[model samples]
Target: MIGLSLNRVLAVLIKEFKQLTRDRVTYAMMLAIPVVQLTLFGYAINSDPRHLPTAVLAQEDSRYARSLVSALKNSDYFDFVAQARSPAELDEMIRRGEVQFAVTIPGDFSRRVARGDQAQLLVEADATDPSATSGAVAALAALPDQALAHDLTGALAMRGQAVKPFEVIVHRRYNPEAITAYNIVPGLLGIILSLTLVMMTALSVTRETERGTMETLLATPLEPLEVMAGKLAPYVMVGLVQTAIILAMAATLFHVPMSGGWLGLSAGIGLFITGSLALGFLISTVARSQLQAMQMSFFYILPSILLSGFMFPFRGMPAWAQWIGEAIPVTHFLRVVRGSLLKGQGIGDQWRELAALGAFVCVVTALAMARYRRTLD
Candidate 1:
C-alpha cells in the first residue's frame, strides 16, 4: 500500500514539473525575476544622495570668495563643476541641466568684511527635484562658516583687523530634511498598484481564455461592457485588499507615514486600480494567449519601472526621458501619492494628478470596452 501511494505522489509531482517546464516564458520568469530584481534594487536604489553638480558665480576674486569656492570643492556631496561670470550664465547652466546648484559671491565680499559691514553670500539651488536639492543645500550650509573663518584669520594677519559680521543663511524651501523615504515611498505606491493589478488581471483573463471558458461567457446573454465589469469587479476588491496590506506594511515595517485622510487615500487607490485594470483588460484584448499576455505585461512593466520617479528623480532625467514618463499613468499617480502622503497635501493640491489619472481611466476603459466587444463578436 505504501509503495503504491509513493508511486502515485511521484507521478503527480512529475506531471506538475512537466507542465511548468512546458511554458518557456513562465520557466524563465521563475528563475530570472529574482536575480533581476536583486541586481536592479542593489545598485539602483540609493538612499544616500550625493554628487550634486554645483556651479560658482564669483564677482569677487577676493580671498573670501576664493576660499568659499575651495571649501565647496573639498566637500564630497557637492561637485564644483563650473564657474559662471553672470547670473544669466548660472541660470543657463541650471536650465541646460549642466548644474544642480549655483553660488554667487558679491564683488565687495572681502571689502565689506574688512570694514566690519555685513557681507552676504548668495546661494541658488535647482528646486526641480526636492531630494537632490536638499542634499546640495545642506552641503552648502556647512561650507560658508568654515571658509569665512579661514578668510578672517588670513585677513587679520595681513591687515591687523578682527573678523565679524559675516553670515551664511541657507534657503531650502521645498524639502528641507532630504528625507529619501518620503520621496520614494509615495512613488512606490503607484508601482505596487500597477504591478499587482496588471499582472493579476492579465493572468486571470488569459487563464479564462486558455481554459476555453471565455468563449462560453461570450455565448451568454451578457454584453461586453457587462462582462468586462463583471471580470473587473472581483479584481477591484482584491486591489483594495492588497492596498490595505501594502499600506500596513509600509507603515509598520518601513515607518512610512500617511499624512492624507484615509478617505482620500482610498479614493486615489481606487482610481489607480481602475486605470491599471483597464490597462490589463486592454492587454488581454490584444494578446492571443496567456504567454503573449504576460510578455506584453512585462513590456509595460519595464518602462514604467525605469521611467517613473520611483527609481530616480524625474527632474534628474533628461528632457526626452521626462516626456516619456509623462505619458505613463504611474507617473501622475506617484505625484498624487507623494504630495498627499509626504507633503500632507489635500485634494486641491493634487487635482492635476487626480485629473490625469481620471483621463487615463476614461481613455483605457474606452479602448478596453471597444476591444472586448470585438473579442465577443
Candidate 2:
C-alpha cells in the first residue's frame, strides 16, 4: 500500500503545475476570466443608468417649457439628443429606440400655467427594459414641485403653491406593467443560442480533430466551404428547434407579446444562428484540442452574456463597453428579438440590427473558411 509520502505529493504537485503551464489557453482563461468579470462588474455595469437619450418636442418657447427641460437635464437622468419637429417624429424616435424618453410640451403650456389651470407635460417612455427606465421615471416625481418654482415666482407665486402644480403625465409605452419576463424571455433566445450552438459546434469539430478523423475527412474531395456547410447544417436545425421551443414557452407560459411579425423574427434568427455556428467553426480552427475549443467558447460566451445587455442594461454600460458590445453578434440579436417580441418592430424598424447580424455571419463564415484552408495546407 502507498503511504502518504511528502516527496511523492510534492512531485505530483510540481508535475500538475508544469502541465498547467503547458496548456497556455486554459491557463490564460483562468487568469483572464476573473479579471474580465471584475472589470465589467466594477466599472462597466450601471443599474441606475443616467443621461439616457431623450427627445424634446416643445410646442411653445415659453419660460415654463424651458424650465421643465432644464430640470429634466439637471436631474441627470435625461439627456436631450433630438428636437422632434412634431408628435409623429417624437413617437417615431421612441418606436425606433432612438431615444429612451420623449417630452412634449403643449403650445399653450405657459398660458395655462399662468392662469393656474391644469397644465399637462407629456412624457412618453420606452419601457421595454423596465429597470433602465425606473430610476428616470422616479426622478420625474420631484420635477413638478421644483421645475416651475423659479418661473412661478412673483405674481404667479400662488400658482406654485398648488399641491401638484402642473401635471406630469408619464406614458409608459411597451410593457406598461414592467414585467421582467417580457424583457428576459425574448433575450433568452440569444443567450441560449450563443452558449449552445457555439460550444456544441466547436466541440464537435475539435472532437474529430482529437480523434484523428479530421485528416481522413480532409482527404475527401469536398471543398472547405462544403465541409463547413455539412458540419453546420445539423446544428442549424438544432438552433431552429431551440428557438421555436423558447419562443413557444415565452408566449404560452410567460404570455410575452409577439408584437412583430414572423418574417422579421425569422430573418433575425436565421442570421444569428448562421453567424454563431460560423463563429464556433472559426474557434475550432484556432483550437488545437476539444478542451481548447471549449475554453475559447467560454471566453466568447462570458463577454456576450455580460456585454450583450442580457444580464444588464446595455445603455447602462460605458461608451467603451458599448462599443465592444456592438461588435458582438449577441448584442444585435438581443435588440432584434426584444424589438420584435416586445415593441412589435418590423424589418424596416430593426434593419440596423439585422444588418449587423448579417455582417457577422459573412465575416465569420469567411474567416472560418480561410482558417480551415490554412489547416488543410
Candidate 3:
C-alpha cells in the first residue's frame, strides 16, 4: 500500500473548501438556517402567552362586575376586545376564533352577591390549543377570592372571609379534554402536504435540468402555465392521497373527531396543494440544481413549521413572527383544517382563511410563470 501523503490530503481539503464556498445557496443555508432557528426559538416563541383576546358579555352594570373585569385585566392574561351582546354572540365569537376567552356575567350577579347567594361567573375558553389557555385558566382560581375584595369590606366582610365570593365556572370549549392530538392531528395534514408537495415538485423539475432533459422541454411549444400545470397535476393527486392517508389515521388511530364541514375541508386541502406545487415551481425556477432546490425548500419549510402554529401556539409568537406566519400558506391551511374538523366551521365562517390560501395560489402561480424562461437561461 502507498504511504499516506499529508500534502495531497491538504490540497484536496482546500479544493473542497473552494467548492463549498462557490455554492452560495448551500453556504447561505448553513449560516442563515441556524440564525433563523435561534432567533425564532429564542425570541419569537413563548409557551406562556399573555394578553389573549377576550370577549365580555356583561348583563349587569354593577361595581362588583366592574371589579371582576378589572381583576381579570390586572392578571395580564385577558385583553377585552369585544363586548358580546348575547350568549349566542359569545359562542359565535369563540367559534370563529375571534377571542380566546368569553366572559359572561349574569344579570343577577350583583344581586346574588349582595344576598350572599351562589353567584356564578361563566368563563368559556377556546381550548383548541390547551397550552395557550392553560395559564389563563389557572389564574382564574385566585380571582374568586380576590376579585371582589374591596366590595365586600364593611357589611360583606363575612362573605369574603367565611365563604368564597363567587364561583368562576370555566367551560372549555372544542377539545374540552385538552387532548394534544386533537390539535396536532389536523395540523399534521397541512405540514405533511407543505413539506412533501413543495420538495417533490421542486426536485422533479430541477432533476430534469440536471439530467439534461430540460433541453427537450425547451424545444417544445408549451407555455409556462401549461408546463407548470402539467408538471404539477400528478403531484396534486399525490398530495391528496397523502391527505387522505393522514386523515384516515387521525380518525381511526387517534380518534380525532371530524365534527363536520366536509366541503370546507376539501376546499382547503385542494387550495393548499395547488399553492404548495406552485411554490415548488417557483423554487425550481430560482434554483440551478436539485441540491439548490432542496436547500431552498428547507428554507421555506422550517419557517412554515415553526411559525405556522404547528410546533408552537400562533398567538404565543411575537407580533413580527405572527405577521410572518400570516403570510405562510401553512398558517391559513392549519386554521382551515382545525376549524373544519374540530370546530365544525363552514365555508361562510372560514372564508377569510380560504381566501388567503386562494390568494397564495394565485400569487405563487403568477410568480412561477414570471420566473420561468422557455430558453432555459
Cα RMSD (angstroms) for every candidate in the order listed: 7.2, 1.5, 1.2
Candidate topping lDDT: 3
Q: How do the residues 253-364 of candidate 1 rate in per-residue lDDT, one tens digit apiece?
A: 7666576645556567778899999999898877767886887788678758876767776555556666777788888777666655654656755666778888989999
Q: Pick the candidate with the highest TM-score.
A: 3
Instruction: Residues 34-111, candidate 2: write the lDDT tens digits.
Output: 999899899999989999999999999988899999999999999999999999999889988899999999998988
Against the hidden true structure, what lDDT does model 1 obtain? 0.71
Look at candidate 1 and tell me the lDDT of residue 68: 75
The TM-score, computed over Cα atoms with residue i paired to residue i, of candidate 1 is 0.63
lDDT of model number 2: 0.91
lDDT per model, in order? 0.71, 0.91, 0.92
Residue pairs whose backbone atoms clash in candidate 1: none
TM-score per model over all chains: 0.63, 0.97, 0.98
Q: Could you tell me which 10 consecutive residues in candidate 2 have the lowest summed lDDT?
A: 156-165
Off by over 4 Å in 2: 374-377
Which residue pairs in model 3 clash with each other? none
Arrange candidates by TM-score, descending: 3, 2, 1
- Cα deviation at 97, candidate 1, in Å, is 18
Clash counts for the predictions, in order = 0, 0, 0
